[model samples]
Target: MKMSDVAKLANVSPATVSRVLSNPDLVSKETREKVMEVINKVNYKPHIVARQFRTKETKIILVVVPDITSAFFSRVLRGIEHVAVKNGYQVILGDTENDTDRELEYINLLLQKQADGMVLLTARQDKEKLEEIAEHFPMVLACEYMDGSNVPTVSIDNISSARKVTEHLIQQGHTKIAHITGPINVVLGRDRLRGFQQAMMSHDLEIDSAYIQEGDFTFESGYNQMLKLLALEAPPTAVFAFNDEMGMGAIKAVKDSNLLVPNDVAIVGFDNIKMASVIEPNLTTIDQPKYEIGKKAMELLLNLINGEALQKKRFVMKDELIVRESSELVKNMP
Candidate 1:
């Protein structure tokens, strides 16, 4: 039913009904109770579209992810949505497909008042443009961070996590460990690569140039890089992939070459995605708390949107190592 009908039935003007709906405290206690009763009786619904137009606040938060198809990102999205819905806010998702131009375009949409704030999964973007957008908007970085910027970010310690993974390989008596990673432009990729290098250097292992390969964090890239590594004169006895997809690809490559995992060449991957457990060999990788990261990022963004003082500029989540059949140490020597 219309607000006019409710107003007439409640013995109040339309303006009074509107005020009660928007801010009940502004109306008298008796009048507010009466209006609410009428509203309940009629099951009256206010025109949120018009109200949003008038207030210029849509109460919507936009989440821009680099690859929405990744199980890793899906979990993160769920975390953000859960906290957002609990706080009486709506979330809109945008997948940029790792395209810098598209990412920038999505960020530009915020300027048109389509969304009140943004949660970005970092991709390659113009730093100056991002800083410009952040000046007037509430934004949080999830699963990635930008160096030399004060942007609020929630992510795991990639360097330490990668080092741990490398250390595990070392403990397995695998001295010739190879590393595959994503593009160096992204923070996570660079940090993980650095972690791998640091761990090798600390152990006095030569950081062989030929043992490192770069991928685009894609399954195909992983497969291709693994093939290239396998073609080397002395293939690594163990391989470390930056993410789960690449690690899976590496597994496929190894199988195609008629080699056994952990026996001929052990493999470890990052991002303990759900499929990691169900896969044939089961993946050994770093377990990042994707859902918690998303939840915490949204909570921080909501607080910032509410003009609350933020005690910290950045937040780092911890990572865990899950050993599986894929990276089991070689037992018997031929």
Candidate 2:
């Protein structure tokens, strides 16, 4: 049934029906209930497809992630899907796979009115381009943030989370701790690296340049970076990978080298992904509320879509460290 039919049944103008749908709070409780009762009795469903032709809104939110294979993104996607489905909206996924050109293409699609809003997982795009796009549509930055801009974002305090992981390693008496990180250009990568540095400096320990290696937040990159560290003349006693994928990779690399984990070398990782606990040496890492981050971002986007005023621009989630066998060297002793 059309909204006009519902409006006629409820004896109200179609504008009132539109207001009730967009912002029920703007209408009185009695009017809102009366409209909803008629909506339910008639089972009226607006033709969103036709509405899009006139209003330029498809009621679809595009979620862009660097990679879909990573379990971290999977949880985040779940959160977004949960909220989107609840609010009578649809979500579309765009996997950029760390390709800047692909990212730009997806953004261009959104700009062309194929989608109503976007949630970006990377910060590699041009700042000016993003600012220009923000003028016309609502956008939320998830898992990463733009440099030198106040974009509405949903993410954990990466710097603090990374510092906590580093401190955990230090407290275990690992002076020569190594770091395996994602691309340095990404905000999370840089913040995590800075946290590692800050933790080392706080203890009056020199941040050894040799112990630092860069990865692309992939398992293979983690494995190769670990190999490089192990080949060094004086390999570090402990290692910290930015994510669980790399952390698992580090464990596999150490195992292949015939080294005993936590005994010969300790390892820690971030993002308590599902596989973290399943691995032989359970990983000690920071637990980011990945699903909650996704859910909150969608909820905020819905509020914006409904014309609700936002009290804050950024939503910062909390992170926790889950200590397991991987980083617990002494605790693992026989």
Top model number, TM-score: 1
lDDT of each: 0.89, 0.89
**Cα lDDT of model 2 by residue, 1-334, tens digit:** 8888889999999989988987888999999999999998988887777788868788899999998888999999999999998876799999999898999999998889788788888768888888778667777888888756666789998998999999999999888899998899888899999999999999998788989999999999999999999999989989999899999999999999999788888999999999999998999999999999999988877776677777987888999999999877565332
Estimate the TM-score for candidate 1.
Answer: 0.92
Off by over 4 Å in 1: 13-43, 332-334
TM-score, every prediction: 0.92, 0.86
What tens-digit string does per-residue lDDT give for candidate 1 at 159-201? 9999999999999988899999889888888999999999999
| Model 2 weakest lDDT span, ten residues long | 325-334
Q: Give model 1 RMSD, 1 decimal.
A: 2.2
